[model samples]
Target chain A: MKITILGCYAATPRSFTNPTSQVLEIKNHLFLIDCGEGTQVQLRRNKIKFSKIKHIFISHLHGDHFYGLVGLVSTFRLLNRENELHIYGPKGIKEIITLQLKLANSWTNFPLIFHELTSKQPELLFEDSKLSVSTLPLKHRVYTNGFLFKEKAGDRKLLIDKAEEYNIDFSLFKSLKKGKDVVSEDGKLIPNRLVTADPPPPKSYAFCSDTVFDLELVPMIKNTTVLYHESTFLEDQRELAFPTKHSTAKEAATIAKEAGVEKLILGHYSTRYENIELFRTEASDIFQNIILADDGEEITVE
Target chain B: MKITILGCYAATPRSFTNPTSQVLEIKNHLFLIDCGEGTQVQLRRNKIKFSKIKHIFISHLHGDHFYGLVGLVSTFRLLNRENELHIYGPKGIKEIITLQLKLANSWTNFPLIFHELTSKQPELLFEDSKLSVSTLPLKHRVYTNGFLFKEKAGDRKLLIDKAEEYNIDFSLFKSLKKGKDVVSEDGKLIPNRLVTADPPPPKSYAFCSDTVFDLELVPMIKNTTVLYHESTFLEDQRELAFPTKHSTAKEAATIAKEAGVEKLILGHYSTRYENIELFRTEASDIFQNIILADDGEEITVE
Candidate 1:
C-alpha cells in the first residue's frame, strides 16, 4: 500500500504549502481523502489522473477539509467523466454540493452518489472484493470521521503441481484454496494444507486528522500497518491542543504507542511553526517508527 | 486607478494557470472582482494584502468564478480580520455561503454583509467619496453581472493661488469645488470654471466575463477609461463562442469599439490556446489600443 500526501498544512493553503488532502493507493483503489481548496491544482502538479479518483472521503465539514470538493466535482464534469463518483462525508455534504450545481445550472453527466455519514459509531463506509473501509470516530470541533482502509486477505494460492501430483481434480482446487479439505474420488478426505499454501497476511491503514487525542480510538486503530495522525501542534503548544481539538506531537505519539501501529505518520502541521524538526524530536521520544508527512511525500506500507 | 490580474484563464485552474479573479484599485478601495478557486494563494503570490480586500464581487455562480469564496472567507476569519466584508453577487450567493459556514460552525468573527443582485438592469452597488461602482448585467449561461468601477470626479483641483487672487473665502472654496459660482468678499462673482479645472475627466473601468457579445451593456459602460472583456475563443472558434455564451477576441473588440473605451483589455482565454498572442492579434485587428490581460499583468486606467 502506498499513500501520497497532496497537502499536509493546517488552516489555510499557502503559495508552497497546501491544506489537508491525500491519495491512498491500496489494493487497486485510489481513494482521495479530505480535499481542501486547490486540490485539483495539486493533483495536476502531482501528475495524478483526475479520472482515477472514483471515491472521495471527507473527514469533516470544515472549509479546510472539503472546500475543494465542489471544484473537483465540477472539473470531473468538465472532463466528461463517465464513471459514477462516490462521495462519503458528513450529513450536509450532499446539500452543500447540489446547491452549488443547482445555482450554476450545470449538473454532472455521470452518476454522483453521496453516502452522508451521521453515525458517531464506527460504520462500514465501503467494501469491495479486495479491501474494506470503515470509519474511525474522532473528536474534533465538528462532526468528523477518520477512515480505516484494510486489505482483505486474498484466497489462498493454489499449488497446481502439488494438487496434480496428489491426483486431485482441477475442480477441487477451488475448495482447497478456501481452506476446505477436498474429498477424493474414492471417498478419502485430503487435507487442504497439502495442496495449498496460506495467503499473505492482511494489511491495514488508518487515517485520523483534525481531532484531539482520544484514547478510545486506540482500540479501533490498534495494530494497523500504517497510521496517519494529525499533529497540528508540537509539545510547546500541548495546552492548546485539546481546546482546539487538534493533537500535539506528543499526544499523537502517545496514541500511536498505545495503538501499536507499525508506522506512525504525523502531519497536518500548523503554519505558525517554521521548523517541524521539533515535532519529529518530540514524537520520536515515544514512537520510534515515526514518519513526518509533508506535501508530495509518498510512504509505502508492507 | 490600477488593476491587477490575479488570474485570467477560462474554465478551471490548472498547474500554472488560474481562473477568473482580479483586483481593481480605484481611489483607496481595493475591490476584489470575481474570486475563482485558488484565489487566496494568488493573492499571496501577487503580494496583495488580505486586509485590503474588504469587498469581493462575484460575477456568477460558476464554480470557476466563486468556488474560492468560502475558503477566502474562512482564511479571513483565521487571520482574525476585524473589518466587515461585503460580498455582492447573485441572489443565491448568501444561502450558498451561509450554509457552508453553518456546517463548519465557523461563522466569521467579522460581520459578513451580502448584497444579492437579481435585477437584469444596471444598479448602483457601491459608492464612496472618490469612486462609485455599479453592476452591468450581461447574457450568460447563468444569472451573471459584470461590474463597473468608476471614479467619481474628485473635488475639482482647488487652484489655491487662483482662489487667493480672487479674494474668495476659504469656506466658500468647498462650494467652488462643487462647480458652483461663488461671490467674493468684494461682491464680485467668480466663475467656477475660471477658478477650477476638470478632475482628470473621472476615470472609469468595466469588467465583463463569461458573457456573450451584448450591445445592450454598451450604453452603461460607454466611454469608460478601460474595459476588460472575456475572449474565451479566437476567430476560429467564433461559431462556438455564441453557443457557450462566451465572446471571441473580435467580438470583445467590437464591444470595446462601440462603447468607446479608452483602452480595451481582453482576458479569460480558453486553456485550449497555447499562445495568447493570437488573442491580441485578433482583438487589435478591430481596436488599436488593445491590452491582452495575462495573469500578474498590471494596468493603470488613466
Candidate 2:
C-alpha cells in the first residue's frame, strides 16, 4: 500500500503550504481523503491520475478539509469522465456540491454518487473481496469521521514440492490454496496444511484528523500498520487544542503509542509553526516510530 | 489603476496554469474578480492583502470563475475580518455561498452582502465619490456579465502658479479645483480655466471574460483605458470558439479595436497551446497595444 500526501497543513492555504488532502492507494483502490482547497493543483503537481480516484472520503465540513471537493467534481466532468464516482462525507456534503452544480447549470454526464455520512458510531462504509473500509467517529467542533482501510487476507501460498510429494492432482491446487483438504488422483485425502503455507498478514491504515485528544479512537485504530493522525499543534499549545477541537503532536503520539500501530504519520500542521520538524521532535519522545507528512511525499506501508 | 493577474487560463486549474481570477486596484478599493479554485493561494503568492478586498465581482457561476469564492469568504471569517464584503454576481450566488457557510456552521463575522444580477442591460452595481462599477452584459453559455470599473472624474488640477498669479485666496482653492470661478483676493473675478487644468483623464478598466465574439459588448466597454478580454483560443481554433461560447485571440482583438480601448489585455487562454505569446501575435494583427495576461503579472494602467 502506498500513501501520497497532497497537502498536510492546517487552516487556510498559503503560498507554500496547503490544507489537508491525501491519497491512499490500497488493493487497487485510490481513496482521496479530505480534499482541501488547491487539492486539484496539488494532485497535478504530484502527477496523480485523476481518473484513478473512484472514491473520496471527507473527514468533516470544515473549509480546510473539504472545500476543494466541488472543484474536483466539476473537473471530472470537464475531463469527460464516464465512470461513476463515490463521495463519502458529512450529511450536508451532497447538498453543497449539487447546489454549485445547479447554479452553474453544469451537471455531470457521469454518475456522481454521494454517500452522506451522519453516523457517530463506527459503521462500515465499503467492503469488497480484497479490502474493507469503516468510519472512525472523531470528536471535533463539527460532525466528523476518520476512515479505516483494511486489506483482507490473501490466498495461502501453495507449497508446490510438498503438494507433488503428497501426490495432489494439479486440479486440486485451487482447493489447497483455499485452505481446504484436497483429494488426489488416486483418491487419497491430503491435509491442506501439508500442501500450503500461511498467507502474508494483511495491512491496515487509519486516518484521523481535525479531532481533539480522545482515547476512544485508540481501540478503533489498534495495531493498525499505519496511523495518520492530525497534530495541528505542539504540546506548548495544548491549551489551544481543546477549545479549537484539535490535537497537539504529543497527544497524537500518545494515541499512536496506545494503539501500538507499526508506524505513525503526523500531519495537518498549523501554519503558525515555522518549522514542521518541531512536530517530529515532540512526537518522537512518546512514539518511537513517527513519520512527518509533507506535501508531495509518498509513503509505502511495510 | 493597477491590475494583478492571479490566474488567467481557461477551463480547470492546473499545477502551472490557473483558471480565471484577478485583482483590480482602483482608488482605495481592491476588487477581486472571478475567484477560481486556488485564488486565495494565488493572492498570497502575489502579496495582495486579503483585508483590502472589500468587493468581489463574479462574472458567472462557472466553477472556474467563482469556485474559490466560498473558501475566500470563509478565510475572511477565520482572519477575524469585521469589514463588510459586497459580492456582485448572478442571482444564485447568494444562495450558493450561504448554503456552504450554513453547512459548515461558519458564519462570517463580517457582513457578506450579495448584489444578485438578472439584467441583460448595463446596470450600475457600485458607486462612490471616486469610482463607479457597472455590469457589462456579455454573451456566454450562461448568464454572464463583464465588469466596468470607471474612476470618477477627479478634481481639476489647481495649477498653483496660475492661481497665485490670479491672486486667488487660499480659502477659495477648493472652488477653483471644482472648476468654479472664484473672486480673487483683489476682488477680481478669475475664470476657472485660467487657474486650473483638467485632471488626468479618469481611467477606466473593463474586464470581459468567458464570452463569445459579441459586438453587443462594444458600446458598454468603449474607450476604456484598459480592457481585459478573454482569448480562450487562437484564430486557428476559432471554429471551436463559437461552439464553446469562448472568444479567440483575433475575436477579442476585434472587440477591442471596435471599442477603441487604449490597451487590450488578452487572458483566459486554453491550456492546449504551449506558448501564450502566439495570442499576442494573432491579436496584434487586429489591434495594437496587446498585452498577454499571465499569472502573478502586474500591469499599471497607462
The per-model lDDT (C-alpha) reads: 0.92, 0.94
Task: State fnat for each of the candidate structures.
Answer: 0.94, 0.84
How accurately is candidate 1 docked according to DockQ?
Answer: 0.86
Tell me model 2's lDDT, rounded to 2 decimals: 0.94
User: Which has the greatest lDDT?
Assistant: 2
TM-score of chain A for the candidates in order shown = 0.95, 0.98
Where is model 1 more than 4 Å wrong at Cα?
A: A158-176, A181-190, A194-196, B159-176, B180-190
- For TM-score, the strongest prediction is 2
Q: Please, what are the lDDT tens digits per residue for candidate 2 over residues B1-302?
A: 89999999988999888899999999989999999999999999999999999999999999999999999999999899999999999999999899889888888889999999999999999999999999999889999999999999999999999988889889999998888999998999889999999999999999999899999888888899999999999989889999999999999999999999999999999999999999999998999999899999999975
Worst 10 residues of 1 chain B by lDDT: B149-158
TM-scores for all candidates?
0.95, 0.98
After superposition, the stretches of candidate 2 with alpha carbons farther than 4 Å from their true spots are A185-188
lDDT of 1 by residue, A1-302 (tens): 88999999999999999999999999988999999999999999889888988999999999888999999999999999999999999999999999999999999999999999999999998998999999999999999999999999899988898888778877888898788998766677889888889898889989999899999999999899899999999978878888999999988999999999999999999999998778899999899999999998889876
